[model samples]
Target: MQQSKFPKYIFDWFGGLVLLIGYIIGSVIVGFVGVAGKFIFRLDFMQKPWFLMLSNAIVFCLVIAAFDFLIVRPKTGKKLNFNFSPTNFYTYLLIFPMMLGMMFIGEFFTAQIPTTGPFFGDYYEFFENLMSGLTDDPVLMVITAVIMAPIFEEIIFRGIIQKGLMNKGVEPWKAILFSSLLFGLIHGNPWQFVGATLLGGVLGLVYYKTKSLLLPMLLHGFNNLCSTLLVTYTKNESFAQAFKIPEWEILIIGIVLFSLFCYLFMKKNKVHYSDI
Candidate 1:
């Protein structure tokens, strides 16, 4: 293992902090740029699909690069693993459905909680607006959400933050749990929080075991792709009502199938990291 430049405590804490700071700074930069563009060019920058998508991609890339240089590079002497293998490809096929099923389970539980009145309603509306971009620019949305997002997110959360914690002698579960929690928190809403946390835990475990970032990236991409497709193709009421038939029965069946897939995943791929 390569030695970190900072002390163990500093390295560990900074591992978590860098991403948070990066996101805040990235958002600020993007906001300022958008405002300036609107004024100087006399263009409605936000309404331009290509500009919005390109700006988002640029901001995400800059955040990743900042985290890499400021936090990851100073600590680790080597680059984070991005290697791929046939095993990773095969594992992704199994884990993608498992992760989606887990998210559905999370969604079911989330639905049971009574909203805190208007606040929750406002929050949901805000989230809906964010997603509305998909309808306006399906191609750009797909490229950003389904492709760039997974790569950027996986590199930050799994490849850098979680792996950095482990390198500093943190236990695997602690690293995975904390990183996963941060992953969910970054989504910035209660609805995504539950699902992202559960999914993050699974992805963290996969990275820890396989020691490759590729698998988690693939899984993340697939999850986002499925979500994009579902929302883009289905009307809100139609989609909700489509799942209304025997909801409990379907949930039960989904749970059982998810369990079976998880079992098979563990049985078939016995890759474990002693370091973690």
Candidate 2:
């Protein structure tokens, strides 16, 4: 990897600030669409979760495109070149356990956090209500949460932000950490943040190593789909309750799976891209 003479590309604070502005712009765009929809079609879609997600996807695409084409192109004379290279399909399949493991561990640890405080309690309620709505429409949930969400989220977090930082000379570890922090904060809930950040770090590292977005996207989609199914069927995101196992047992299983993922990730196999 060649290092640039520049200051590793802040892009005006680079990580969280870019996400905040994109989200604010997305919200404003969605608000306008909602108002127009209400006046013209007598329907307000702003309150719908799927519409909000769609708007965010659109905004993220535009923001990154502008950065790549208008700014980065002129400054660096190169596009960000977001990597979505193909990798071993078998290796890709194995990302499932990692997602499941993280989910179990996430739920176990988050269960310990107090959700009774005025702020946390309300946030929990709000998050629950938002997720619970997925149950009412399974197709919509699969499309928005599982498919579109992962694609756009990975494109921004790993593809754009993390890769952008690295291209500008940021160390890989620091880029992953910064991108992971922003990824966690985007969840807007501390309970989800812990797992999201950790998982984000894993995904970021994988993206950097393999130069493939497909694996991370698949892992992210699988994670969100499982959470969605858990919420839809069990009305909660607890792996213990969903699996009919004790929390401790679930936690141990999670530890084992996560450990296995670590082993497999580091163990170079015959697959050309396995340890690339």
Identify the candidate with maximal lDDT: 2
RMSD of each: 3.8, 3.9
Off by over 4 Å in 1: 1-11, 79-81, 88-93, 113-116, 237-244, 271-276
Worst 10 residues of 2 by lDDT: 3-12
Model 1, span 31-102: residue lDDT tens: 887799889988777777777777767777777776667764566554334444435456666776677667
lDDT (tens digit, per residue) of candidate 2 on 1-276 = 565322223343644465566567766777789899899998878767677667767787766665565556676675555445577766665566766777778778877877878888888888877666666788888888899888888977887788778766889999999999989998888888888888897788667767778888988888888888887889777889987989888889998997797678657523433212
Alpha-carbon deviation at 176 in model 2, angstroms: 1.4
Give the top-scoring candidate (TM-score): 2
| Whole-structure CA lDDT of model 1 | 0.71
